[model samples]
Target: MGTGPAPGRERFLAGAAEVGLQVDVVARAAAGSLAEAASLLGISPADIVKSLVVKHKDGTFLFALIPGDRQISWPKLRALVGVNKLSLPPADVALDATGYERGTITPLGSTHPWPVYADAAITGKRISMGAGAHGYSAFVDADALTAALRAVVADISDPN
Candidate 1:
């Protein structure tokens, strides 16, 4: 599930439309931190989300959508995933798995539709996250995103 060519803009947009998920794609520059990025984007830190790819020992993977203001609570996520061990795969491994670089990984255009887990705190907000490419972000309603991906909504993160 972690080996394949990266998908491009075509697939990214296509996947979103296929799932009936409305997204607003915007260009962005590198920032020192999430807060700075949000500030530059004229949004709150909570609006900036991170898509974390968790690798299981069995080689399967899952997507953890965490708000910038919070972090993945390993114990909570572990329990939800019912796994004893999970890790952030190396950059190369992650790229191979989802066809997107670490900074631009998104399930919207991932090579495989790995299970997605979204933190409940973000459910009713509009959030921005990786858009399958560097220098870009995808803004979407969390509810729509969760529904589109059929994500498991839970308390998988802790305030940062």
Candidate 2:
């Protein structure tokens, strides 16, 4: 399933709407970094959320929503999720787990509906994240996203 084409923009927007969120779609260039993405979206690096797929030793998967200015702290995340071993899955595994490509993965409309773990700093802020497609991003209230996804918010990141 991961080898197939990823979903389109409408799917992401529709998924957000289904959860009562109205996000603004921001155009992005392919393979852009957080800085580039923020620049393109007219926001700050801290305002960009990165949607990552992580796996546990027991095969449980999670969506780690980290801010662009920070990197996920493996130790912090392990402690938060009560797991000793956690790793970022390969691109195919990520796509299979989230139904989105590497550069365009989000938890909003995932095929597996994995649990979401967001950094606490994202609370009460506006952020940009991948929108289930390449070359596009979604801008929305981080609080709304956390509420909708029932995200476990914690300090699971460190300055990049």
All candidates' lDDT scores? 0.87, 0.86
List candidate 1 segments past 4 Å from native: 1-7
Task: State every prediction's TM-score relative to the real structure.
Answer: 0.92, 0.92
Write one digit per residue (lDDT tens) for candidate 2, span 1-160: 2522345566677779888987998666765477877887788999989999999899879999999999999999999988789999999988888778887888887888789999998999988998988888888999999999889999999999
Q: lDDT tens string, model 1, 53-126? A: 99988999999999999999999999998988999999998888888888778889789999999999998999
The candidate that wins on lDDT is 1
Superposed on all Cα atoms, the candidates' RMSDs to the truth, in angstroms, are: 3.8, 2.7
Q: After aligning candidate 1 to the native by TM-score, how far in Å is the CA of 43 from where it should be?
A: 0.8
Q: Name the weakest run of 10 consecutive residues (lDDT summed) in model 1.
A: 1-10
Clash numbers, per candidate: 3, 0
Residues forming the 10-long window of minimal summed lDDT in candidate 2? 1-10
